[model samples]
Target: MISTEQLAGFRYVQDLQDQPAALAATLDSLEASPAPGDMADGIVRGRFRRVVLTGMGSSFHALGPLHLRLIESGIYSLLVETSELVHYLPALVAPDSLLVVVSQSGESVEVIRLLEAAAGTAPVVAVTNTPSSTLARESQFVVETRAGEEATVSTKTYVASLAALEWLGAVLTGAGVPPVLRVFRSACAGMTEYLSGWPAHVESLTRFLEGVDHIFLVGRGRSLASAGTGGLILKEAAHFPAEGMSSAAFRHGPLEMVRPGLLLCVFAGDLPTIGLNRRLAADVSRGGGKVAWIGNDADLDALRVGVSAVEALPLMEILPVQMISLVLAARAGREPGAFVRLAKVTTIE
Candidate 1:
């Protein structure tokens, strides 16, 4: 229940609020038409020498989970941006490579160029919202996200791409994915719950973030999807400067940048790395930096949004950051994601 007073005509805020339905619809569309064609079967069987995942912006970030999952499931995968895949790494688009491309519009310039570069060599599995766009038309296997229309600055499409990629991961890994899908169902409600508390979440996080001269979003594993996208959208939607990097990377040099007005949101992600992230929070605090732990383990009630399972963590993790962007926009007296110069779709590489 976000009021208009807070949005400042920020259409992307509506896009963010549309996520619950968008996710449900995308999941339903995926379930209703769950077939990946013969090329995908070969890739799933590890017949391909390499599997390359390519996209740009949030679409690229959404592939983080699937890329890691494919590697863990014994499928050799490389996560490369479409721009890189098309020009510099065209050799990687070999006959034995399975290319998985994600784009909500499916007509972005990079996607078109990647399709041209990989045309006859690789078997492509395209996950996109548009059924007739270049990516969909050129792909051998299409996994349509069905996120519908997004105005500006990706929100629904980002979540929907993540959902579509999750489904793709399940199909390739042959894992028991009923619980995964169930967790997706829970994610919609989790987001709805968070959005319902939007007024409070915005005010509190804004106040928490007040006087924060710089922002750093850090996370590990799948949470990196949120961390990376969160940091990007804060800049796009709020025009605020933020950096999203790995928790380990932050410790190397950026840790010294921690001073008053510097706020770090550390994702206490999965079990294997959660402890390490928590320790980083402790170390940041000891170094006089403000640290906010995110995840079920976060000590603050405001930061902890209940996620149903680890499968749902990526979807859950971005909600608070979305709130931050809205508040930042309102504070700056601008519409969130109103794009003063940037276009919704990247028409040029």
Candidate 2:
């Protein structure tokens, strides 16, 4: 079994190498494009009472942070799965409403159907890794993710999606984009450096995963997005029943299920929320569950830009989780990214 520390470290480095470049490219593209004013002109100026963000899998989880950002800005934004949006929420949309759809491949059938349903009633904005994909072509506006390619699971693409959506948040709220772009650039640099030692970290984490029956991830805000997506990857790649919940929610209920053989991962985002996450980790540990804290001051300097930048924070933090999933899958003797019962593009109604 690999050590817990090694797995944690490796996952961190993997994110660093990939997320930074994607973020830089995303920001550069946004800067060069037609301003949000031109793209959102008629919709924002003349209409649009509500904004709905829709997607599937990791793409769906990416909406968590932006949903909070929108609500904080007084925009009544809704986060719904594309399948659900198509079958049930069609009536909620109209010509004035804005539908933001995120799909890494841009060719998912449900996304395609959702676009068709929103054809004339609302404006569709597609955020996808494939610029030439069908969904991108069908949407009124498209934001391309520069996450390049993935070997199996959604690694860089997930972070790229988050960075892209955060920029959209700034644009929609009329906040200046320059500041966010600068932060993103710095963050990318930090992410790259943080991931440099990923192999070593993965080696450490393997030990804890050796005989674990389940894994639980907890975080809040943007971290919650990470927690959910990370848990999903752990399940898909490692063939484990991994679960994620907001730290607060776990306290309210899920904490009861933790056990000695269980692995619990807590993502501590910023200073304000770190304590809460850490406390949850402690609770899990006290209950005899194996636990780990992904980010702290000791590792923060190693991931910050300049020396290491704050912009790269998310990338650095997210990488370790991805690596853990990858390593666990390899150790479990399973082919990574093999969807046994699910299709790459979910078309179910």
Candidate 3:
């Protein structure tokens, strides 16, 4: 069993515990700063032909929900990684397009390169944790996540960015800020209630994860945010090999790899696809792989994240994966989220 002392020794765990407060602070910042009037007006007036969302790592994953929202609202939206956007798709940074860039540090190499390439051609909306970074200073509008300093692998910053992006999506889509704000507050409370049981969660996950050598996080819709980010953090924090992909995509090819010693954590996403996700989980189990269903109705208590609103589900879906990370770290006898080779910010390309 992982000891409380061991968990407390890592700054990463502390950051994980601090997420609810970071989320609350992000909501407060959103209320205080509001979306830029010109940007919102341009979006509503159709002055911009498209919206391009770009970021790296967890920041990129956090844009999944917003990208879908914009598309559903009939606004053309492009989701691209900052690196690929700078090197392969520079033309997308035209004045006719609006860019939404997310970065915790805001000074990562690709972000800096993109900012230089854009050169004020497009109106940039920056959703970042560092208020004073170049991405914030150079952008036409800024939504500060206010997640504070993260010691290593992203926890607070990722959720904070999600909150900020949700607010941004509501503003750009004219979806009414009051409702989104209410969801944000609810998500914060939900996160606190869920995280309050982290120790027990970790202990329970330790048993579920035993003898597991492979991990995959799969979901659809907004839950893609958690799946993608969860896979990234599992590797970064626990030095474990894992993959995150869409549920449909998994059945396409990766499903063949399912067998004993493999664990699949499936997110029962929004209502439209929850039934499909449940089917996928059942298939994985029948194929002899362990399945952890992440949802309110999960059979395993360790996997159940009690979320009220569908809007709040994405934020809560990630908690189970975080618990798994802790368990993986303890099994490997390493300090979770302690970097052996990576820095918090990527300075090199």
Candidate 4:
């Protein structure tokens, strides 16, 4: 059994707990702003030829939902990492383009270079927690997360940014801000309710994954936000190596690794692809693999975080992974959020 001493004085757990309040405050701020429909008229009449969404780390992964949101609305959109956008795809930042840059810290190494390399004509729509950041000051528009100061991993900021981006998407698509705003308004209570049982979540996951040597997180669509960000934090928090992949993409080759030492966690995404995701989990279990299914019906149900309403499910999906990181770090006799080398914000490109 792992000891609590292993994780004593760590700020990661507190950061995760603060997400509900942080997210609620963020949504509240956006809701009080000018109605989104009235604000997005410039983008609708083709004044902006395309949208480029760029960020790094969890910020990049959070773009999964927004990228799909734009495509669903018949808007031209490109999702690129900040580093790659400035270095490899400079052509995408043209006079007619709209760059929506998502970064918790507005001054990451890549974000600084993006400003340096930009054509200076693209209207930057900065979505960040830091209002006074370089990215926010230089942008034509700014959307603040208001997730407050985070000392460890990006628990509060990531979810807040996702909610803010969803608001941005709703505005661009003219989806009516009332419905989406209500969804996020309810998200505050839902998140607190789900996270109230954090100890139970940690115990359940730790017991189930006691002997697991490797883990894989799988999902599609909005759930990709969880799948990708979950894997990165696990490795960062616990120094554990895990892989996150699309549910369909995993079967291509990773299926061969379905065995006792490997744990395959699957997210039952939205209706269209959920059946296929469930089938993949079932097949892996039949092959003697350990599987944890996160959905409405499951052994380890993660839906308790937030019910599937609007875009809040993605916000909910990541909570369990945060708990998993805590338990994993405990098992390794290490402190959560203790970075041996990597800085909170990457300063070097």
Please name the candidate that would achieve the greatest lDDT relative to the true structure.
3
- Tell me the deviation in Å of residue 305 in model 1: 1.5
Candidate 3 lDDT by residue in tens digits, 51-144:
9999999999999999998999999999999999999998898999899999999999999999997876988899988989999999988899
Q: How many residue pairs clash in model 3? A: 0
Per-candidate clashes, comma-separated: 0, 31, 0, 0
lDDT scores of the candidates, listed in order: 0.85, 0.73, 0.90, 0.83
**What's the distance in Å from true for residue 19, model 4?**
0.8
TM-scores, all models, native as reference: 0.95, 0.87, 0.98, 0.95
* Candidate 2 per-residue lDDT over residues 151-206, each given as its tens digit: 45677788888878878887887778788777777776666665665565556666
* Candidate 3 runs further than 4 Å off: none
Better of 3 and 4 by lDDT: 3
User: Model 1: per-residue lDDT, tens digit, 184-271?
Assistant: 9888888887777776777777678777767899999999998899999999988999989999999999999988888899988888
> Whole-model lDDT, candidate 2?
0.73
Q: Write the candidate numbers in order of decreasing lDDT.
A: 3, 1, 4, 2
Candidate 2 segments exceeding 4 Å error: 1-17, 38-46, 298-314, 338-343, 347-349
Q: Cα miss at 206, model 1 (Å)? A: 2.1
Q: Give the TM-score of candidate 2.
A: 0.87
Question: Model 2: which ten-residue window has the lowest total lDDT?
Answer: 298-307
